[model samples]
Each structure stands twice: as structure tokens, then as C-alpha cells.
Target: MSLPYFHHTPETASNFAQNLRENSVEYVRFELPDLAGLSRGKTVPMNHVESYTLNGLNLYGGAVTLDSASIPIQGTGYNEDINFADCLMVPDPDTVSNVPWLANTARVICDTKWYDGRPQPAAPRTVLKNILSLAAQMGYGVKMGHEYEFYVVDAATRKPLYTGQPIFVTSLLHQHPALDKLMRVLNLSGVDMITANGEYGPSQWELNFAAMDGIAAADRAFVFKNTVKEFLHTEGLLATFMTKPYKGLAGSCSHFHISLYELASGRNVFLDAADKDGMSPIMKQFTAGILEHAAAAQAIWNPTPNCYRRIRPHTFAPSNVSWGVEDRSASVRIKASKDKRQHLEVRVPSALSNPYLTAAATIAAGLLGMQHESVLAPERSGLKEADDSFKKLPTEMHESLAALEADTDFIHMLGSEFVHVFQTVKTAEILRLREDIPAAETNEYFDLY
Candidate 1:
């Protein structure tokens, strides 16, 4: 297949407009990443693409400053109210694709920034960029793939009726006619979907995408979520990425498989055939770093309260900070590959986590390990049976926040100002969750997701 055209400058946007107009494109979807690491955007007429390309589009400043509930925290002192901050959404031309579900509809992922040219601190894309810079300085390039799981429900009835059983089943319970339509839309939108299968939860489905660099991978994730929601809503179905949508069912997770490559020779640096475990010394250090900082990084990987429910033990969910080969029970599982292409799959992250932040934190933590020459012990074969001797991830949101607060090393890596702002906003979310409902009801409601 031909590579999708990517536009990096205003001139490219102008030229792309000609092609879009020639193809009878009616609408251009402006996709932006929000603070919660979700995709939110507007669709404009194709004719207006040039104007937005030249001057950039205006978005509410609250997009980056608000919490998951869209509430503005006054303590952060970023924005006074739910006021729209003037920011520029620059279309990433390379990310443009046509939407097949809607005739003449096209989509483009964008980068958000302040009008003065500074990046929004809470921007997931920018966060990934910062981590990538750190990785580059360490003489390695990070490549990652995302395995996203979610559920689709009837929008009108809000009933989970798609995949019938509470776990992966042979037959789909109520296959909506819109499923095919959504798939077509994603295909046309240039999302490289490897497979879509029933997940271990009611109405839950998982989608896998080809791995790419940090920024590109995160961009694809944002686009994929946006396309799913937009296309499903048009078909009267609601698509949710909420971490644990249903109780008693397997919670949806967004698993990431990360690997590092040599910058100069473009060689996969993680592979070592002579080593009994097939991981190089550098690879061990990287894994050590991730394990060491896994607790502190929970705020970025498992950001929400509901996310905690997915980290329990003996359910294929990772509760301990351990690494093993092909062991699904561990937080970090080393996957077997032919060569340097081998990498570690981090299994503990929830679907609700911000892709940019999660990817950034993983890269930063791994780089830290490399800097310290940390060594990961021999890979354990059976992580499920491993006792509590292994460090476990925080089981509650508040605990995770406290862990983040205590880990000065990881906090320093994320930068003081950004970490402070993130902590304040997240603390407010936990409090809101407490006030919104009783603990039991909250757990039940989230479990039914």
C-alpha cells in the first residue's frame, strides 16, 4: 500500500486541499488530544481547511487544563473558569485519511499548542515528545505498539448487547449492523487494524495496531478512539474506553509493547541470541528501570479510580511489579521475537490512561534504568504464583497518588511544575469520585461499563 501523505507545513496543507477538493471531500475532521488522553475535536468544511492551516484553529484552553470530568480546578491557577483558551491545532498532514462511513468525510490528527508557540503542558502528544527527546539523548529510539480494548453498547438503550457472555465467547450475542460500517470507516481513515476479536468481558472488543515510534503510535491511538466513537455514535451505539466498564468481567486494558533501537545503526538493541533469556544487558537495565518506577508511573498508566479494579491478581491482570518471558500474569512480560525486534510488553495499563503520558513515562523510566546501569534479575517463569515479595502496583487511586508523591526520582523526571499540576488535578478527581456516589455504587457502576 502507498504511504499516507503527511503534511508538515502550511504549503503542504494548501496542496493537500487541492487533492481533497478534487476527491469531493465535504468535511475535514479536526482531531485533538485532551488532558485525559482522550480524543476530542470538531469537523469543519473542507473549504475551511486552508484558513485553519494558515492561522490554526481556536480551542478551549480548558481542553488541557480540565480533569477527566471536564471540571476546571481553580487551585492549578492555569485557567480561571471553563473558559476556552486560544490555542492552535495544527493539522498533521501525514495523518489525514478519508472516512468511509460518512461520504466525503476526512480526518486529520493535530498538535495542540498555545498561541505563543509553547506546548500545552498537559498535552499528551507533547508529553510523549519530551520523553522521546530523552530517549534520543540516551542513544536509542523507542518503538511501541498499542493493544486497546473497549466495549460497544446500544446508545439508545445503554445496554451491553454486542458480545453476549461476560468473557471471550465463540459467538457474538447481538452483532450490530453498524459494526461493519465502523470497520470500513477505520480502514478508510488509514488505521492499521491487525485484528478485532471478542474480549474477556461483556460486549468488549480488542483492537491491535502495528507498532511505530512514540509520537506516531500515540497519534494513531488518538485517531482510533475518535473514529470508533464518531462512527459508532452515528449508528446509535456508544463506544467507551473506560478502563473497567463492567464489574465481574475482565476490565479493558490498553497494553503497550515497547522496545529500543540503536540510534546510529538502526539496530534493535534489545535482542541477544547468545544470552539464555534472549535479552541484552541494556535491555535488562531498561526493564529494571520500568519495574523500579512502575509505582510512581501508575498515575499516568492507570489514571482513573476504575482502573484499579483491573490490577487484581490471578485474573491475568498484573498486580506485581515483575517481568517474565511470555508470562501474561506479570506487569512486564518479555515477548519472544526473532532478533533485536524483541521487546517487553507492559500489561498493567488501563484503557483510560493517556497514551502519550503512558508511553512517555515508560520511555523515561526505561531510560533512567539505562542511565543507572540497572540490572534486572533473571526472568521469572511463573509470576502468577509469585508471592507478595515482588512490589505490587497501587490497588487504589489515592494510594497511587501517594506513591507518586513519594517517588521523587520519577516525579523529577516528569518535571516539577507538570508533576505538581497533575497531582493537584488528579487529587481533585479522586475527591470528586468520592462525593459523586457511594463506594459500592461507584464500583458497581464502573464494573458494568
Candidate 2:
């Protein structure tokens, strides 16, 4: 297949416009990833797309910084502080693609910027790009692969399509026709899906795509999610990436695999031939960096209150800051430890994490480790929960946010403005949810109190 025609320059934009016309494309959706990893933008008619692609689309300034519920939170500086201004959404031409399900509709991911052309500091995508830029300057390029688990249910009833634990069950994988269709659509949309399976939960499923460069991987993840949700919605089904959708069932996770390659030699920096463990010095230091900031980074990895429910024992989710060679229970699992394909799979992020923010946090933490030349700690074995020696992860959203705020270095690395806005928005979410008393709380305490 030919490479995607980027709409970066006027010549390319013209070519894209001509191609759209030749292909009879009617509408183009300009999408920006918001704080919740949700797509926020406007769809333009084909006639107006070229101009918008060359320039930008004006959107609400708070679009990318809005709360999880997409509400404008005060003090974010993106909203009330700026009197609710407008921002520009410039299409990253490299992200242009056809919207498989929509008739003659195309989609292009965008970067958020101020009306006057300044970068949108709090935009999740922008934060990630800045991190990647720093890594590039440090003489390395990152490769990231995202593995997402989601549950499929009836749209109106909101219940699973099946009723049994079916992890890797072949017949169960085909139980829902939508899964196959979704997979095909994703691949057609350039996701390059490599695997699909039924997960631990009754109707939960995971589909993985091939790894790509840092920005591309995150872009694919963002597209994969929005595409799955949007496509499933049209079929009268709901595909939710919520961390713990069911009370007793397994929680969904968006485990990300990361590796660094020397830009000069294009060699995986994590591999070592002489070392007994095959972990290069750079890899060990990077792992140490991830371990050091695990708590603080959890604010982005598992952003929502519901995310904490997934970090319990025996859930294949890490409850502590731990790392081990090929240990799934550890927060950072080393894969292909003795091979050229060595990489780290960070299991902390919930399915609901913003892809951009997650990538940024992971890269920033590793950069810190490299800067300090930190040594990797002793590895944990077996179920990490059984090991008390490991440091505990924050069990709540507020706690994670507090950890993030306290990590001055991490805060500085990921931009203080972005962190401040993130904290403000998330804290607002926490406080808003606090007012609501759930049935579980009422049932457990009302009569006793």
C-alpha cells in the first residue's frame, strides 16, 4: 500500500483534496483526543475540508482539557480563566484515513493549538509529542504497542453478549458476530490487528495491533478505540473500555509495550548479549525510571476512580511498583528479556487511559531514569501481591493525583501547566462524584449508621 498522503504542505493538501474528490469522499472528520481519550471535533463537508486542512478548525478552547464527562471545569485556565475561548485544530496530515463504516467519510487526527498558533500545553497529544521530541534529542526513538481489553454488551440493556469465562476460547470468540466484524473493520482502517481473543470476563475481548513508532502507536490506539466504540454503537451494541465494568468479572486493561532504539544504529537498546539477564544498562536504568515514577504516573495510567478496582490480587493487574522478567503480575513485565525483541510491558494503565498521556508518562519516566543512571531494583517473583517488599501503588484517584503533584521532577518533565490542568480537572471529577452516594455504600452503611 502507498504511504498516507500527509496534508502537511500546500502541495500535499492539494493532492489530498484531489484524491478525496476522485474517491468521491463526502465528509471529513477532524478528531482531537481529549483528556478522557475521547474524540472531540467537527465533521466538515468535502467542499470545506481542504481549507480547514491547510489552516485549521476553530473549536472550544477547553475541548482537550475538559473533565471526563466532557464538562468545562473552572480554574483549568483553558475554560473559565480564559473566558471559554477558542482553539485551533490543525490536522496532522500523516493521520488521514478513510472511515470504514461511514459512507465516503474520512478521518484525520489533529493537534490542538491556541488561536494565535501557540501549542496547547494541556493537550494530551501535544504532551506526548513533546516527550517524544525530547527522546529524539536524547538519541533514541521509541516503539510502542497497545493491547486493549474491552467488554461488549447490548446497547440498551448494557449486559454482556455471553455468560461464561472464555479466555482464549475459540468458539466463544465467534459467539458474537460483531467481534469479527469489528476486527475486520479495524484492520481495514489501518490498525493492522494481529490478535483477537475472548478475555477472562464473560464478554470481554482483547485485540492487538502491530507496534509502531511512539506517535503512530498512540494514534493507532486512539483510532482503534474510537472506531470500536463508534462501530459497535451502530450495531446497537456497546463496546466499553471501562476498567471494571462488572462487579465480579475481570477488569479491562490497556497494557502498553515500550522499547527504545538507538536512532543511530536502529538497534533495540534493551538487548544485551554479554549480560546474563540480557538486559542492557540502558534498559535497566529505563526500568528503574518507570519504577521510580509508577505511583505518580498512575494518575495518567489509571485516571478514573473506577480504575482502582482493577488493581487487586490475581487480576493480572499490578497492585505494587514491581518489575520482573516475563512476570505478568508485575507492573513492568520484561518480555523477550534475552532476545533482540526485548521490551517492557507496563500493566498499570487501565483501558480508559488517554493513549497520549499514557505514552508521555511512560517515556518521561524512562528519560528520568536514563538521566540519573539509576540501577534496576531486585525483581519480584510469583504474584506481586504476595510480595510485601514491593512498594504499594496508590489505591485511589485522589491518592494518585497527590503522588503526581508531589513528584516535582515528573511534574516538570510532563509540563507543570499540563499537570496542573490535569489535576484540577480530575480533582473536580472526584469532588463531583463524591456527592453521589452509590447503592453499595448505602446498602453497607445506611442501616448500620
Candidate 3:
């Protein structure tokens, strides 16, 4: 009843639980986001919700450190030798939403914490919470909108459900009944959709989300990924949020739109009437921060052996750490709008990246820039092909890991334990892939990225 930062007041929680009971909710899924952007949690009877909510559900620490494939990577402290320790997965009452796809079930996202009530430092949600706390200390409240692009394809052949569809075109969606069903379930789950469209790739579809604040946004993103996969698999279809599911396909990028508000005045700090594109001096500094830390953050933003395939020149995903007004090519893109509705659209994170970790990394860079009054360099508008003229980011997963390792201060800021867990797990995967690369044709990426 008295949890800090995870948000539910006792009055509201009791009311919600009462409603769940009256609604005859049979099962409650207590979900947690893992390192590889996958949900790892257990479901309990609704009768146990009160008990778990009060005492906290005991779950393994490796649940947070496991690789995309659920393989216990060699140095994460979650493997056989140094078995995972028990951590508390305390459900946040505020995150409870009906599981529309499941029978009589309701899902709630949780916050991982130590037995002593301190946040589980390495958990993705915990990392985001820490970054949000830091932003609060800086007197900024973040409002973020996340965009996801995914592919729906035939289960056997792995060919697209629809091919050669133009971007933003919805006509092709009619060919995929599974996708049409997914839209209904998403609405039933109370996840708001801003737009849905067929993207540049064959069978690739993009979904944009309405802006939400802090952990709410993270929760929505986590749910969105799982929900899509669940619905597709149930419909006997394969859906992938992988950055690039195929070699020749144009990659799917997950873009995060960020806007900061002054806590006291309730003003959007990124908005300035005097500045062009409404990017204020503060916003400029934040952009500079993201540009400065782009290389290091790529480990968290892209974070896969296959992610490199999408970060090349001419790909919509960023290849350089540059910002531009109305330029889709730059990593930090300022939209073509001058109104107060302006926000920064970060174009680096891959569709497969852990949303919480990605958001934490992004906020960390921006806050660092604000703290130091970092200055933005000249905008690289319309010169995306001039890759040599821009600051390039790491192209390989190992190089990204090295960049992350070299960024000691940021690693410390995001928590050394988290970085260690991430690095060890990724290192093991990199090694494994080098010896025997996984089939690039499989669509089982949710658990086998």
C-alpha cells in the first residue's frame, strides 16, 4: 500500500481489486520486462493477487538478465553455477488492464525490487524508473510516444502476408485477417493507437502510440510487443518486431518522441516560440546530449547481432549521431512543425530493443547534456548520404559493447550491475553466433532474437 514511485495509492488499489473480483477475473498475469525486451513473468489465480500484492511474488533474478533466446548467458550470474537469486516482483495496481486475448484474465506489469524494498537495480523497468527519478530531480517530467514497426508473415514459408506495400497505406491490411483481429484486441486492451499503416517493407506494418508519461509509456510498449506476438501466434501467423527480419528488407525502426515539461509551471520545456522548429536552448542541449552519447547508447538502443544490418546509410534507421530540422535521416530528428506540440523524435532504437532500457539510455544522455549545457553542432539536414561528414556510430554489436564499456560514467549512471548483466549476456550471444550463426530465416524472434 505504501510503495514508492511504482504509483498506486491504497484507496485506488482496493477499489480496482474489488472491481476485478466483481468482474470474476480468474487469472492475474504479473508481468515483468526482461533485458531483451521480452516479458518474463508468471500467472497466478486472481485469489492470489492480494497475497502477491502484499508480500511480493518471488521470482528469479535471471528473469531480468536472460538473453533474447532465454538462454542463460555465461556471466550474468543467472546461469547454473551462480544460480539466480530471488527477487520480488511486486505488481503495480495502476498497470492492471484486462487481457482481452485471454479468457477471464487481467494483466498487470510489475516493478522488481529487492527483499528490502529497494529497486532491483538491473531490471529494465527499474532502470527506467531511475532515469525518471533523475528527470524529476532536474524538474522535468517526460512525455513520450513510441512507434513500433513489425512484419506479419506466413508461418511456414516466412514470406510476408502482404508484399510491396507502400508506407502509410492501409489497404494491404485487409489481406491479413490476423492483423485486423489484432487491432480489435489492442483496442479491447485499452492501448490507444495513433495510426496503423503498411510500411516500406513487404508485410511490414507500423503502429504509433499516443503520448504517455514515464512508466505508463513503458508499460504500454511492453504490452504492445507481447500482445502483437500473442495474437499473431494464436492466429497461426508469425509476427516479428525484429529491426530487420530479412537481409534485403528495409528495416523497422522504433522511434521514441520525447517532450519534457517543467514540473512547477507545467510548461513544455522543449517549446520556445523564439527558436526555429520550437527547439528551445534547453531542447538543443538535450539533443546535444543524445548526439554525444549516441555511440555508447547504441548498445542499449540496437542491442542485437542482427541490428547492424539496419544501421547503414540510406536506411531510415540512423547511421550517424546528428540532428536536423525536418530530416528523417538524422538520429535526432526535429519534426517540421513550429507549434508548442514539438518534440524530439529519436531515430536510433531498433524495434527489438528493450523499451525501458532504451528510454533510460535516451533520458540519461539528454539529462547529461542539460546538466553540462551541452551545445548542439551544425545540423546535417538533407545530407544523409554524406555519411563520412557526420559522426558515425558503432556498426557491430561488439563495437557497441566496447563503446558502452568505455562510457564508464554512463554505465555507472545506468547502474553498474545493469551494465554488467547486459554486457555479459550480449557477449555470450556474440560468441555463440560467431561459432554458429542462427538461421536468419526464422520468425521465432520474440524468444530467439
Candidate 4:
């Protein structure tokens, strides 16, 4: 069957259907984004394409309205008593693609909204839209790329089957057979993967993709995560994107490399080689803004309780708020590129974070810097030495919540409704973890550490 093209209008949709029929598409997958940036979807036979494509599908808004555990909060009016709202999942024609693993199956990502046509304020995609709209007013566009690290383990035994020590050891560089298979699948899916290597943790691996514009990058990240998990499952293995599935080794991180571009000319606005640090004035201000607000942004990036455990010192993780030149310890690292592609990498976020929230927080922080003309202090160096100058990141989930609550300005920027819903949901998660002190929980995190 021929590949399906994205359609944006009614005419385009009609043409797309005709093309799919001509190419003998057997089924379609409608993928909807949940609050955590995970895609949940259902498959329908090709015969229903016309009805599903034009009218869209109905989903229980409760699917996304709840926390990770599927519990709905009464205060949010999303509980069972509120009769749980219904929302529409409208396919983004541009995101249509054929799944390489599933024969004759095409998939399209979707945006959700209320049945009455109001946007779901708690939707991760909508929150991103708010940040992008703000970026538009500054005559700049945001571009980002994510470096995702995960652990591929034996599905049945739930153990590391690969030939390597459980921690950082130089002798563990030999390629694993499963990793080779994963790379082949990634290649078939047309992902521009830049690098793949062993991480400091046991059974952990990292994959970096080429950067793209905001929306496209987010789409790629969403597709990449789902594709990796599905492919691994077929091989009787599990791919975990959890921040700290194993406690002692390095936690999985989803580091974002971000840059700003001029909307009209497509020029890299963060570049200025003439400066001593090779950073433009605007770039300095942006980095400073992010560092200043890094504590508040933790609630969005390191939302889960497990996430706070990964921010400790000496783990190659960012334990405090600081900026540096090519220093990985700093929350924000300024790298000097010989070309105009220079960008900054925010290293504090974990793999389990919602992509939309991460991007929005970064954009909002940078914009705050621009608005206030924030000036960055001298760039720090060295990873081993502790710097007391910058505020330390929250050591626990509850502390992170306190930091988030104190930053009213950033919360307001994210929309009061989103902040409230997110806080409520996350707080509930913390309570759940606190209640269940699973024996596996302590062993899983500390055994390898």
C-alpha cells in the first residue's frame, strides 16, 4: 500500500481517503494524547474511515482528566459523580503514518476538546499551544530536540539479561543483541536517531534524535516512545521510560536541547560568536531566566516522586540551579557551536516528564528573561565542586510542590486551571506512593545504587 499523506481540509481529507482505499489500507489507529504525554488509542477497520475521519471519535474525557493511577478528583469536577465529560479526538491529518510493525495499519495523532468545542485546558498539547502563542508575540519560534534514555529488560524475568555490570563500568561497552534489533526498528520507522549508547545505569540505553521545530519535535518524541515500547514488547522485553526504574545507577533522563529562531528570516537568534562567551545578549537573558525559575519548573519536569530521587548530587544529575559552559552538572548548559546552530541544554528533567509541559516551562522561563532583561552572572565550571550560589533543587516530591506553589507568576503563566489540576493530580500521586511502601520499591531503586 502507498503511504498516506496528511490532510488538513475537507477536500484533502476526501483525497486522503481515496488514496487509502486505493492503497488497500486495512485499518486505522487513532492516537490521543493524555495528560502525561502518553498516546492512548483504538484501532478501527478501514471501512469506518469516512465516518471516523470527518466526524472524529468520542473518548471519555476521564481518560485524560485523571492522574496516572486513573483516579478522578472530585474538586476538578471530573469524578464519577460529575458524570465524567465526553471529548472529541480530532485526528491531525499531518501526523498520519503507517506503522512499520503492524501490517496495513495507519496511525494519526489527535488533539482532544470538550464536546461543546471548548479546549481541554488540562490537555498537555493545549498547554504547549499557550506557550507557542506567547512565543509568536516575540517574533521568535521555538525549536527543540530530546535525548531519551530508557532501560530494556527481560519482560518475563524483569532482570538485566545483557552482559554488563549493573552499574557504570567501562567493560560494558559491548553491543547487546536486543539493542541491535531496536536500532533496526528505529531505522525502519524513519527516525533520525543521532546516537545510541550504554548509560551509566545497568540495562539502560540512551537514544538522541536530531532537533526539529517545536511541534514536529514533540510529534517525533511521542511517536518514538510508543514505537520503542511496542517493538520491545514483541521481542518479549519491556522498555521502561520511568525516571529511576533502578535506584543506584544513573536515572533515565530526557534532556532537551532548545533554541530560538527568528520567525521571518529563520535566523538563529541565540547566536553571537563575537561575544566572549559566544552567546547573544538575548541568549544570556533567556538562560538566566531559566536558571532563576528552575526550581518552580521542577513540578512540571520532575513531577513524580521517583523523579526527585534522581536529582541527587554525584549522580551526573543536576542537583542545583546553575548554568555553565559545557558543564553537565549545571541545570542549564551553554554549549558553543562553531556554526549558528548553538543552543542550550536543560539537564534537570527526567524521562517520565510530559513533553508538552517540559517545552512550555522552558519557553515561559526564557520569555520571562527577555521581558525583564535578566542578566546572567559569570558562567560556572567543574562538575565535582558544589556551588552554593544557586538554589538547590527540591530534594523530595513534597518539597518540589512547595517550590511550585510559591512561584505564582510561573503558575499563572501556565494558566491557573492547569496549575491547579496538575498540582492536585501530582499531590495525589505522592500520597499513593506514600501509602504503598512496596518492598520492590526500595529494592528496585537502592539495590543497584
Candidate 5:
């Protein structure tokens, strides 16, 4: 297959636009992620792509600093007073790709800017890029892969796509024509889907991606989720990455498998030869740093109030800050692997997490560990569900926010400006939900507790 048109520089962006014009592509969408990991952006005609690519289009800064419901926090300057102005959206040509399900259209993820060409720190994508920038400066590379367990249901009836006892990794259960179509669309849109299978609940699916660099991996995840939602809708089905969709069924998780490498040597720094379960000193320090800040980082890993509902026992959604060799129930799991494959699996983050912030928080914490040469606690073996003695990670949004508030040093690691806005917005969401509890209360949820 021929290479896609280039977009890494201004000249390349202009050339890419010309290529799109030659192909008669109609509209191009400039996609950006909000704090909720939801796509929000503007669509422009082919004639306007070049101008927007260079000068950028203005958008609501609140698009990056708001609650999951898109409500603006009072202090983020994204409110009615400022009219959510003063931000520019610049498309990354390197991220441009064709939209398989949408007719005559292509899309590119964008970065936010202030009028002065400064990075928009409150932007989740910006937050992540800032961390990646530091890693690049330090001659280190961060790599990650995401595994999202999600559910598909009928659009009209709002239940599982298939009815019957769900089985894990059963080929028969994954034979739906729509799933084949979904996979094709994802691959066509530049998503390298590693593997996919049926999970333990009705209509539930787990899909994995090959490990990629920090920022690019997040972009890949954004496209993966976007394609799944669009393809499911096109197939007359509704799919949700909501952490917990039902009362008794196992909740889905968006787990991240992560590792780091030495940029110069191109070696997987997370592991070493003859290392026990890949538990090198650097790896242990990274795990220690993540564990130390796990409570505070929960503000991003499990951002929404609905997130905590999924942390039930025996579900593989860990509720504690623990590590173990090949233990799926530990919050940070050191997977058993060959020397090159040594890495960690972060189990707490869910499918609905904002990819940018999730990447930002995880990398920031790990870097802090390396900076301080933090020590990993003794590794626990076996599963936590089988034993209830493990120290629990914060299980509630308020608790996580409180931990964030108390850890001023950790908050400073990602910039105080961004952390302050994030905390305020999330806390406001909790208060608003509490106020709505009486009217919104149902069988599954009551009082936003």
C-alpha cells in the first residue's frame, strides 16, 4: 500500500491538504479530546484545511478543563465570563487519517494553544505531551499499550448484543458480522489491533493493542474508541466503555501495559538480564513511585464518580496499591515475561479514562520514582480477591481528590495550574451529583456515594 500523505511540518501539512483535495475529500474534522476522553472539534471544508492548520481555529478552553458532563469550573477561565475563549486548536498533521465509516471525510487530532503559541497546560493532551517532553529531554522513552474491556448492546432495547451465557475468549461468541466490520474499520483508520476476544460477561469484549510510544499510544487509543463507537452505531448497536454497566456483571477496565526504554541504547530499561520477574532496580523504583502516588493519581486513572463502582472483589479490578509477579489483581502488576517483554500492567485505570491524562499521570509518577530513586515495596503474590488483607487504594472520587490535595509535591510534578483546575472541576461534579441524587437515584445508584 502507498504511504499516507505527510503532515509533520507546515510544508507537509500543505502537501497533505493538496493530496486530500486531489482525492476529492469533502470535509476534514479537527478532533481534540476533552477531560472526559470524549472527542470535540470542528469540521472544515477542504479549502480551509491549510489555513486552520497554520493559524489554528479558536475553541473553548473549557473543552480541555471541564467535568465529564462538560460543565465548566468557575476558576479555569472557561466560564461564561470569558465565554470559554482564548484558546487555539492546531491540527497535528502526523495524526491525520481517513475515517472509514464517515463518507468523504478524514480526521486529525489536535493540540491546544494560547493566543501566544504556548501549550495549553489545562488540556489533557497537553498535560501528557509535557510529561513526554521531559522524558525526551532525559533521554528516556515511555511505551504503553491499552486493553479495554467493553460491552455491546442493542440500540433499541439496550441489552447485550447476544443473549446466552457469556464465555471468555470463546471464538463462537466473537463471530458476529458487526465485530468483523468493526475490526476492519479500526485497521483502516490506522489502529493496529493486536488481539480481540469475548470476555466474561454478555456482549463484553476485550481488545488489545501493540505497545507504542506514550503520546502515539494515546492517539491510537483515541481512534480505537472513536471507531468502535461509530461502527457500533452504524451497526444499529450501542456500545459503552462505562466502568460498570450493570449491577452484578463484571465491570470493564481499560488496563495499561507500560514500559520504559533507554533512548540511546534502545534497550528496554524496565527489565534486565537475570532479573527476577523483570524486577530490575529501575523497574522497582518506577513501581514504587507509582504506588506512592497511586492514591493521588486516582484522580485521573478513575476520574469519574461512576468509576469506583467497578472496583468489586473477584472482578480483577484492583482496589489496592499492590504489586505482584504475574498477578492480575495487583494495582501495578509485574507481568512474567522474557527479558525483552518485562513490563508492568496498571490495572486500575478504566476504559473511559482520558487517554492524555491517564498517560500523563502514569508517566509523571514513574518519572518521579526514577528521580527520587524510590524503592518498591515487597511484591505480593497471588490475587487480592482471594485475600482481603491488602491495603486498599482509594475507592472514591472524593478520597482520591483529598489525596491529591494533600500531596502538594506530587501535584506540582504535573504543574499546579492543571492539577488545581482538575480537582475543582471533579469536586464540583461530585457536589452536583449529590444534589441530584434524590431525583436521579435508581436501583444501581443512590446519593452519589
Candidate 6:
């Protein structure tokens, strides 16, 4: 019933089993975040959980590279190449949490490994872990925060809970009991939520939680999305993190915040009082790296064809690869606090992005910056989208994927295996999208042709 922070071992698993008995737990959901960041795993009865926790459970290896439709793609080197292999889902005991809304149910996050005991390199969570390891070797520890915007709607009707563009409206914030219930459950489940409010779009809401170190932060984000959707579904409502569900409305986004700390001294490494802009040289280089690979990174950030629609002008989404201090208009905004609190806010990721991949790609790019001592361009003043000085980002999923394929340096840093699997899965999605014709397209071309 309490938040657990321990490694998975025989002793720890035994202790966890004892805790489950104490809490009268009936089932444990051994969940894995799949390629599209969907929660996919097995549910085990409490009687079998201890053994599974210690020994791990079997899962389809192809799950790690499944498309948005949950179909495993071929030629990804995970499915057919391995003859549809099974991967081990080894539960990380530290990620155990009580399912506050589901009585007698608990959840534990897991990492995937091949049957032969090798970590699944193409797994999003594994990719993130490797990137964090690289950062640690460079004497830096990463702190991360996520700001997520999503829409709540009636599951049957698919209509917004309310109809208004009321950002930060007090009455609107409390308009739904679902919001209050969600906040309460998340806090009870150890999300450490800080704020929940009505966003710019009707039925849209933004909730934020406390930051944590690298892998832990990404785990929290993955848990947050799954919890919201599951709990809301039980309440006869649907919570969607889709990039854009309605036209002429604000799209959902998950903005990521990151800053590095000196591992040896345990001090914030991005702050520099002597610098004119109050940013340390490391921070600038990190920003430079992010900008340099923004286009390629977009393949991960905006994975789906629909996700690119959220990046248009005046949508509060970035259209160009640019950074500015406190500039929401820029792709990467430097929240300059002139103190330890200073960090980079990457606003490019859509809500549908896998948190693990986002963190991995961001960290990988920044590390390249630090490694090469990359220089940042001058900060721009006006709206980056309007500024001809700034270069435009990839406008479509295909373009982004191509950019990702071309960026050998970035791909090398992120691990070619992971990148290859990601590209294959996303490319499959694009091929499927190309065959589908929307009603708008039919309306515009059917009669004319």
C-alpha cells in the first residue's frame, strides 16, 4: 500500500509479498510500457506474484516495437527475425504502487530482457536507462519534470466535459468531479502532484507533478498517463493524450524539463552567476545539441502522422528549431531563473510521445552537445515561427523519420538497434496512413475528380 523503492531480489520480492498480504492485495498488474508507450503486460494473482517478481514473466518481444494499432511490425529485428521471441518482464520493485481506484489491485513497472538474459536494447525504457548511464559516466545526473495536457471526454458521446476556452478559470478547474478525483488518486498513488487546471481548450486539462531523477521521472510520467486513462475509463469517461482530437482547438502536449547536476559535488551544473545570461557553458552546449538534432528527434517526439498536425503556426507548438529565454514560441525554451532552478524546457513533444523515448533522445542530444562543446546560436527575440532567421522543423512524420535516419551521429548515440526498431515501427504507421482517405479529402476531391 506504500510507495516502494527497492531493487528486485529474492529478499525484496519476499518482503513485497508480505506487504501485499498485509494490504490484502488480490492481484498485481505486471505492466510494461510498449513501443507506443501503451501499458501492456500480464495480470497475476497475488499467490503467483512473488515468484514472477523474482523470476520475471514472459512477454512478446515484438511488443517493444508495436505500432500505434498494437500490431507488431516485421523486419524490426524483434519479431520475425527472432521467430516471435519472448522477452522477460523483470519487475523493478521500486516502481510498485497501489492502484488507488481498483480495490485489491496493485501495479509494478518492469524492464524487458531477452530470454537469454540480455537487456532488450530496443525497449524504450532500456534505451532511456542506457542514456542515463552515459550521462552518469560523464559525471552528471539528470533531473526531469513533465507537463502534460490532455482531454477528458464522455466515453460514449466523445464530447468534451465542458465547452469553453477557459485557461486557469477557477470555476472551470473545479467544474468536474473527475478532476478532483483524479488529483486525489494520483497523490495517493505517489505522483506528488503540484497543480491541476483547465487548459486553453474545452475539456482539456493540465496537471503537473514534482520532478525526480532521470529514470524515475520517466517512470512517473508513464505511470501518470496509464493511471489517468484507466481510472477515467472506470468512471465512464475517457482521458486521451492524443496530440490533436479536434480541429480549431488546442492540441495536447507533454513539455519536458531537464537540467543536469554535477554528480561529484551534487550541485546544479547548469547555473552560472558570472555568465551574462546566467547560463553555464554546459547549459548552452546542451541547448545547442538539442537544436541541432531537433528535426531528427521529432521522429520520436511526434511519432504518428496525426501528431504533426499539432505543430502548425499559432498553435502554441513549435514550427521551427529555435530556442529563447522564457519563449514559449520557441521549440526549446530556456526557463532562465538565474539560479539552480534554471533548466531547458523542450516543448516539441506531443502528448502521445513515449516519455522514455523523449527523455532518451533529449539526453542523448544534450550529451552530444557537451561532448563536442557545441556552440549555441544567438537567442531570438520574436515568434520563432515568424522569424525567417530560424530554420523550420520537419512538417510531416515521413520527413521526421527520414531526418532521423540521416542523423548518423544522433542515431549512434541513441543506439542503432533502438533507433532502427523505432524507425521501422513508425514507418509502418506511415504506410498505413497513406492508404486511408479522410472525409475531408473525399469531400474535396471525389466530386471534382
TM-score of each: 0.90, 0.96, 0.93, 0.91, 0.93, 0.96
When summed lDDT is taken over every stretch of 10 residues in candidate 4, the lowest stretch is 1-10
Candidate 2 residues 1-449, lDDT tens each? 01111225687667767888897889999999999989999999999887887777899989998887778999988988888999878887678777899999988898877766688889888888889888988999999988999999999998888888978999988977888899889987889899988999988899999999868899999999999999999889998999998898899999999999999999999999887778899999999999999999999999999999998977798999998887888899888567768888999999999998999999999999999999897765576767988889999999999999999999999999999999999999999999999999999999999
- Candidate 6 runs further than 4 Å off: 1-9, 447-449
Q: Which stretches of candidate 5 lie over 4 Å from their true place?
A: 1-13, 22-24, 81-83, 169-172, 386-389, 438-449
Error of 4 at 163 (Å): 4.9
Against the true structure, candidate 6 reaches a TM-score of 0.96
Tell me the deviation in Å of residue 165 in model 5.
4.9
**Per-residue lDDT of model 5, residues 84-129, tens digit only:** 6757788876687889888889998888877766676777777787
Query: Could you tell which candidate, 5 or 6, scores higher by TM-score?
Result: 6
The list of candidate 1 runs beyond 4 A from truth reads: 1-10, 81-84, 162-170, 173-177, 338-340, 439-449
Q: Tens-digit lDDT track for model 1 on 1-449?
A: 01111224767767878778988999998877776866677898977988887667788765665788788787664666324457778777677787777788888777776777766666666667777877787787888988888888889888876544545453572365666666667767777877767777777878677888757888777778777887888888898998887778778888988998888998889988988767888888999999999998887889888899888888777998888888888888888674767899998888888777888888888888989999887765555536677877889988888988998888777766567778889999888888876678778898798
Worst 10 residues of 5 by lDDT: 1-10
Over 111-207, each residue of candidate 6 has an lDDT whose tens digit, in order, gives 8887677888888888888888889889999999888999999999999888989998979778778889999899877799999888999989999
lDDT of 6 at 2: 13
Candidate 4's C-alpha lDDT?
A: 0.78
Report clash pairs, candidate 4: 247-445, 248-449
List, residue by residue over 267-292, the lDDT tens digit for candidate 4. 88899979876799989999988977
lDDT of 3 by residue, 311-379 (tens): 988777789878888778888888646665778999989999888888899999899899989999867
- Model 1, clash count? 11
